[model samples]
Target: QVCPGVTPPTGAVKVTPGHSPQDLALARAHGLPLLSVIADDGTLRPPGGGWLQ
Candidate 1:
């Protein structure tokens, strides 16, 4: 379910636990994987284990 005050533009949400605190909470609550795709420098990091390949 979406967060209480959040309204997704597409009427759907993409969980990004590594980048968003709200998403992290949602991911943890749903036992979803936490993946990091961007580095601290704001660049796309190499895909790990073919996660985004």
Candidate 2:
């Protein structure tokens, strides 16, 4: 965990392992900053961060 104790960034999505790249791209194009791409083992990772304010 990079920042274990720190609060998670707002507007973050914990994506499942099966989420498609097309969905990811759409989210990004629509300004979805915080993308949580899941691994095969159900591990969640933050690829980027976005501001909702």
TM-scores of the models, in the order given: 0.45, 0.29
- Worst 10-residue lDDT window for candidate 2 reads 44-53
Candidate 2 lDDT over residue span 1-46, tens digit each: 3445557645555543337777677667777655355556665544
lDDT per residue for candidate 1 within 1-53, as digits (tens), equals 55777655347767878778998899999998776767787666767524654
Clashes of each: 0, 0
After superposition on all CA atoms, how large is the RMSD of candidate 2?
A: 12.5
Instruction: Assess the local accuracy of residue 47 in candidate 2 as a C-alpha lDDT between 0 and 100.
Output: 51
For candidate 2, the per-residue lDDT at 28 reads 70
| Residue clash pairs of candidate 1 | none
Models, CA RMSD each = 6.6, 12.5
